[model samples]
Target: MSIDLQSKLTPLPRLYKEITLDVGGEAVHLIIRRPPRTVMAMLLSEARKAGELDEQDKPKDGGCAMRLMARMAASVLYAPDGVRPLYDRKNPEVIENLVENAEWLLDIQEDVVGALGANGAVVERIQGNSEATQT
Candidate 1:
């Protein structure tokens, strides 16, 4: 006997983005997923610590931004070589490498988040076809 099972479709699909970097002249890509609610909470915590958030509902400047960016990159950036969680770096050499490339890492992270928001943004135009087209 054969059986089939299917679940109802969700209104939205998860989003993913890929960024390529030059590491030792070799191309490396970090694929990132749009962070879920839990992950977003974590990110906000880090941002608050880094002075990126404030009670006045504005961003503040602080020295911890680099560290926060590195940590955020570690959270989202996935490696093809299976090196996981750069935030918990134990290898001194890898830690140094990431520190040296902190700016680039932040750049990639921002790019991924930006693209995810820009491309995945939704719009509703009642006059248009109702196939859930985007703006």
Candidate 2:
């Protein structure tokens, strides 16, 4: 028996997440969208561009890292409950917090890199250790 070509076709899996943060005793929510191929392409292109940053690329307040985090935050993030249009939440304080407390961000990066076949170790480690098991 031969395999059906249609049955062999599968779409790439995407992983989405909702991350919550506490700032000044208020809940801040982020609906983090998983990057599809197009978004990933844009990210890669932007990263390459970042490496060639000139003097003008620097923020006046010396917040290059915050700016980068803000850009990434803006790209994938859906606003919290009270916010609208997403851009409203991309402020300095919110962006600073995202850059400061970014454990989940690293996890997402590892997952994306693993899914893209760039970092086998991350997937392997997660699989081998069962780290993703939730209580």
Candidate 3:
């Protein structure tokens, strides 16, 4: 399952363009940068080379990696500068909606990743994806 998802999805780009959000009277702009593939590759390779899964109790199906990615994505999406407005003195509902959406996305990502095996490459891909949306 992990392999299939990895194959289906392309690696996220190195840097995503800046996005602007209207926060009350101010506009907040930010950019999400993709994590270096080398870093991800090294991390995964080290884990595999260590051959210490038994000691670490790492999931055989990359569950850990999936969760990490999901959480990371959720964090960004919920950030004040991300989807939700930063200082909307007039509207508080927008913030609530954004939080709800972010939570939903996080849950879905977790479920999807959990079903997939803990593949090093897939994990790396997810990290890349998270970085791509970091803004």
lDDT of 2: 0.44
Worst 10 residues of 2 by lDDT: 52-61
Q: Write the candidate numbers in order of decreasing lDDT.
A: 1, 2, 3
Pitting candidate 1 against candidate 2, the one with the higher TM-score is 1
Writing each residue's lDDT as its tens digit, candidate 3 over 20-127 gives 545555765543434333543443444445442223334334443433343333223223234331223123344344434434434344333333333544544554
TM-score of each: 0.50, 0.40, 0.27
Q: Model 2, 1-135: lDDT tens per residue?
A: 334654355432343566676655776776655444564345434533655223333222334433443445455555544222254233556656655765455445433343344234323332333332332
Candidate that would win on lDDT = 1
CA deviation > 4 Å runs, candidate 2: 1-15, 52-70, 80-135
lDDT of each: 0.46, 0.44, 0.39
Give per-residue lDDT, candidate 3, residue 15: 40
Error of 1 at 31 (Å): 1.5
| Model 2 residue 117 lDDT score | 41
Which 10-residue window in model 1 sums to the lowest lDDT?
120-129
